[model samples]
Target: MEHVVRLEQVSSQLLAVVRRRAGVRELSKIVPEACGIVWNVVRAQRVAGAGRHVAVYLDDQINLEVGVEVSTPFAGHGEVIGSATPPGLTATTTHYGPYQRLHEAHEAIRQWCASNGYRPAGPNWEMYGHWKDEWNNDPTQIVTDVFYLLVADGSSS
Candidate 1:
């Protein structure tokens, strides 16, 4: 599939995250569980705009933050911790398919960066859209946005 990679500025976002060092095999199990924990906390705390979910990859480990956008930050408790999504210039693309195929989107971004004289400056992340019933039957209906923080000067910082 053709991916349209674009450079855009992402604003800082509040996140409720669970940080862990695990291989790709463990992500399927860990991410969902973390999302559940975050959701429960959001409900209990009555956090507004609690819906969007994010999985941020910090190095080989994953810091999966599942929460909605909030106007302000909140104190973190237990496994649910408060953090800000990386904000700056980012190369982003949307992947339309099952989660298993997300790597293609990442690879496409990497290629786009290299060809355009840019490089990943920091951690990357994936923002998952609201789940729809149709998505269960049609994997292509699922949507995910992948972002890679870009080096300020198009070179290693």
Candidate 2:
């Protein structure tokens, strides 16, 4: 996919998440498991303004936070804890297609950063857009925004 990667500054966001450490190969399984648990908590708590599901990838070993957006930090239940994505400069892009092709957006950002002089700061996340029923008619209409935090100096730390 041709991603229109851009640099921007973002503020922190609160997420009710279940954290885990896993390899890339395990994401397909663990992500859903975590998201499901979080969703149950959000519903039971009636957390307001709960929004799209998010998967935050923290490091090389892949410390992960999978959950939905919450309005504020709350008393967490079990593994569903109050967590936040960092505020900083980032390389971001929007992907329009099926989730399976979402990785292409990440790759696009990585390549853009490499060629344009920037370094990943070890955390990246995917923010899934609210689903549209029409997407079932054309999976290519699905939307996801990908973000990679960048080092302050845009240099490898």
Number of the top candidate by TM-score?
2
Residue-pair clashes per prediction, in order, are 0, 0
TM-score of each: 0.91, 0.93
- Give a tens-digit lDDT track for model 1, residues 1-157: 7889999988888877666666788878877777777788878988776657888887644544555555567677677778878889999999999998899999999999888888898689888988899998999989999999897665642
Q: What CA RMSD would you report for each candidate?
A: 1.8, 1.6
**Which residue pairs show backbone clashes in model 1?**
none
- For residue 79, give model 2's deviation from the true position in Å: 1.5
lDDT of each: 0.81, 0.90
The candidate that wins on lDDT is 2
lDDT of 2 by residue, 1-157 (tens): 6999999999998899998988777787888788889999999989998989999998878898899998878679877899988889999999999887888999999999999989999899999898799999999999999999999877743
